[model samples]
Target: MQFFVWAAWLITIANYWFGTKQWDGADFGVIFSTMGISSLFMPTITGIIADKWINAEKLYAILHILYAATMFYLPQVDNPHTFFWVILVAMCFYMPTIALSNSISYTTLKNGNFDVVKNFPPIRVWGTVGFIAAMWITNLTGSKASANQFYIAGVSALFLGIYSFTLPACKPQNLISEKKTFAQKLGLESFKLFADYKMALFFIFSMFLGAALQLTNAYGDVFLDEFKLFPVFAESFVIKYSTIILSISQISETLFILAIPFFLKRFGIKWVIAIAMFAWVLRFGLFAFGDPSANLWMIITSCIVYGMAFDFFNISGSLFVETSTTPKIRSSAQGLFMMMTNGFGAVFGSLISGWMISKYFTTYYTNIGSLSKYVNSEADNAHLLNFLKNKGITVLQNGDLSRALDVKDWHNIWLAFTIYVLVIAIVFVVIFKHKHTRAEVEAINHL
Candidate 1:
């Protein structure tokens, strides 16, 4: 339920804005940044509320209900500016629920005398299943580029918000009693984890890596959908089923989530995170070269690698925080993790990428047959190309400028992302230090 609510609109939103609404790409980054902006403080604030006053499950349900109400208003927003504020309001209510859900799951499992490390991944895998289901439903229903996607998500969220109340209760630990320090009473001590060098470094890196998490989500579907503009791929299955094809990544997530226990126990959190970083490099590299015809294998392989890239960092990082923090600040610590990855990191990634794509990689092209003699003539062609070049738009070989179809230099865009992730992986391996041990693996069960 948690997964479906967001998935219905999250992945397909680019299509609605770019393809359907024909909005400027320069403004698109801020839309995704809404998630990050809300994540910046909402999670921590809600975490404090859950730890100090409210029941975590009830708080989570309330947030979802509020989020659903906000989502229902999104379809009525006519411009990017208005949509930004609306989505920001929606995300403020939604982002914190992610951490709360994790906390509720951990608390419930521990209360039932279950092994979190062994049991949590299987349960989490079902979230990915729900995500995949939402994507299929959205795509198959032909709502990918319509306001109907928002309606679908709003209804699902409303249902989930109500349903969350019936789940096992996760009552607050009431760690805010008068005997504690004022900081503890206010639930501010979670911020003190940054005083620890190791935890601080871990969070800094998590923020950097978080930037990479949403890049694909922001553009992957539109990237495939844009291929339809090319005559070669106008009727390709990929164009028709871009959402379902992207859902392959979520499907891969399910398989990898189940493998988290073995990987975590064997490779440890540090190594698992390193592996995930490198997987991002590979995922982008594949997308940089992949196409619908003969090179479709690369696209599929990229989707397969997404499983490792996402689960290894996200699920493993959540567990690492769970085992490392004390009961009093457990929920707060989870919220901190979400803040770093989805908050600060996401803000930088989305804003910068949008600006960069608009300034450097956005191109204009039309069908080959649309070219007139002035552009087709060998002598005038160079002059035309030079004009477009001066305006920061490249004219691909054999492309026509008569109709001026706005497109992207997708190859270079993905290539840039590949290089960025690759550099991060190399630096991380050199500096971030941790050693895997049987004892640390055993400690998870005790936690």
Candidate 2:
């Protein structure tokens, strides 16, 4: 249910921006930033409440219920300003539960005397499966661009919110004995982890990669649906069902997450993360060259690679923090990890990428009906290109300007993303160092 809450909207948000709202690219940044803004404090604040005042499962339930209610109202919002605040409220309810869910799972596992390191991965894999299932449901049902997608998400969330209360209780540790300040009780002391050279470097890299994560979510659907502008490709499967096509990525995520234990055990964290970083480059590069018609294979392959690209870093990085940090500060360390990646990193990526798209990828066409007037003269074509390029615009040469306006700028936009991945990969290669072993896993479990 938690996974689906995110999947239902994440991929299709771009479609909503470009298709339903007909909003500018810069506005999409505001949409994506809600996630980051919510992430900035929601997880930590909720963590404190769960630790001190509320039961984890109960808090989780309340969050979901609130989230569902907000989602139900989202389709009614027409103005972007109203939409932003509504989405922000929804995110506030939604984001904290991610960490809360992890906490609930870990507590449940420990109380049951199950080995978390051995048992948790298998259960967690189901969350990814749930995510994929949600994506498929939304895509197959053709709710990708409809307000009904929120209805689907809201109904499911309401069920999960209620169901969470039925789960096993996760009580507070009460470790301090005497009451400490709220910050101290919540494990804010974990901030000291930043003082460690290796830990700091790992976190910095996580931030960089987090930046890459939002790119596809912000643009993938818009890119696929943009093909509808071309008459020949308008009827293509991808154009008609872009969300379902993109669901392939979530499906791939499930498979790769199941493989994480083997890969982490065999290659260690460094190599696994390197593979993820490089895979991101391929993911974007493929999108740069792929089309619904001739390059459908590239598009599909890119989706397949998304599994490895995302799980390799996110799951592995979380485990890395779990294993490396002290027990007293473990939860706080996880929150900090999230803060860096999902908060600062995501905010920067979404806002900047949105600006880039609005500035460089949006195209304008003049004298559209008189093709010969513009195309036959080389000087005229160059003049047009220069004019568009100077305005950070894309010029579609496919003889149909109106339909191609939204996507023509994608070529240049994706190139810039490709460059970002390359630099990030290089930095990861230089800075991050970690080795996973059975012995180390055993040690963490003991702790």
Candidate 3:
């Protein structure tokens, strides 16, 4: 249920921004920035509360319920400014639950004497399943961009929120049993992990890779719907139900997550992460060339690669931290990992992508008059072709008038992402030296 709330709208918001609200592309940057800003502080603040004052599970439940309530009110707002505030409020409640959920799971596993390394992955896979199911529900009900989708998310969140309260109680360990400084109480001491040269480099690159995480979420659906500009592809399943199509990535995530332990054991973290980085290269490059009709395979393959691209780095990185970091500051280290990837990483990714889209991917074609000015270069022509192909719109390849394609423009965007991934992969290969071993895994579990 937690995963579903995010999956339902994350990918489709760009469609809402560009298509339904007719908002400026730059404004969408500010919209996505809300998640980053919220992430910067909310999780740590909530973590402090869970650690010092309240039961983690109860806090998790309350946040989810609050998130659900805010989501219920989201569809009522029409203005972009109002939507931003509402979504920000929703994120404040929603983001912390991610950390809280992990704490709850880890605590529960430890209490049961079960190996979290061995058991938690299977349980977490269900969350991805939940996410995929919600996407399908939204798509089948024709509510991907409708207010109804919020209600779908809200209702599910409410259930999960309440259900969370019933889970095994997770109490504070009170690691700081004696009087301590403010920084120590807040887990700020974990920042010392940065002093280790290898750990510092790993975190630095994590932030860089984290930036790529939100790119597809911010624009994938918008990219698909942009296809409607072309007459030939607009009515096709990919354009019309792009959110559902993109759900394939989450579906792939569930399967790939199960394979992580094997891959980690066989290849080591460096190779695993390098493969994940290359997967991102394929992901964005595929989008550069794929269309709804002829290149549908490219799109699907990109979605498949997302599993490896995302899970390899995120889950495996977390495990790496788990096995390496001291138990006294393990939770704090995990939060730091998240801060790098989801907080700083998301902020940079959203801001940069928004700028690139507004400045570059958006182009005016002189030949089509008013229509050309509004179309997106990436998917607009494809959409135009889709409309012509499916709806029989007349398209003329003219002699006197020529269509100016944004060839150099989009090439730069893909090139930027490719370079970013390549650099991250190379750095990971050169730095990071920790190896996972049975004894190390056992020590981590004992913690």
| Count of clashing residue pairs in every prediction | 0, 0, 19
lDDT of 1 by residue, 78-194 (tens): 898999999999999998898789899999999999999779877887888889999999999999989999999999999988999998988878754457776654446788899
Model 1's number of clashes is 0
Tens digits of per-residue lDDT for model 3, 25-51: 766776777787788789888888888
Order the candidates by lDDT, highest first. Answer: 1, 2, 3
Q: Once model 1 is optimally superposed onto the true structure by TM-score, how far is the C-alpha of residue 19 displaced, in angstroms?
A: 0.8
Residue runs of model 2 more than 4 Å from their true location after superposition: 171-175, 365-408, 431-447
Against the true structure, whose TM-score is highest?
2
Assess each prediction's global lDDT (C-alpha) against the native.
0.84, 0.81, 0.78
lDDT by residue (tens digit), candidate 2, 1-447: 789887887788777766766666777887888899999878877877887788999999999999999999999988888888999999999998988898899999999999997898788778877887887888888888778789988999999999998999997765557767767765677779989988999888888889898898888887888765544565788987888888889889878876877777667777888889999999999999899988999999999999999989987788788778878788789888888889888988889998888877776444344434334566656655553343344545754443333434677677789889989898888766666666557643442
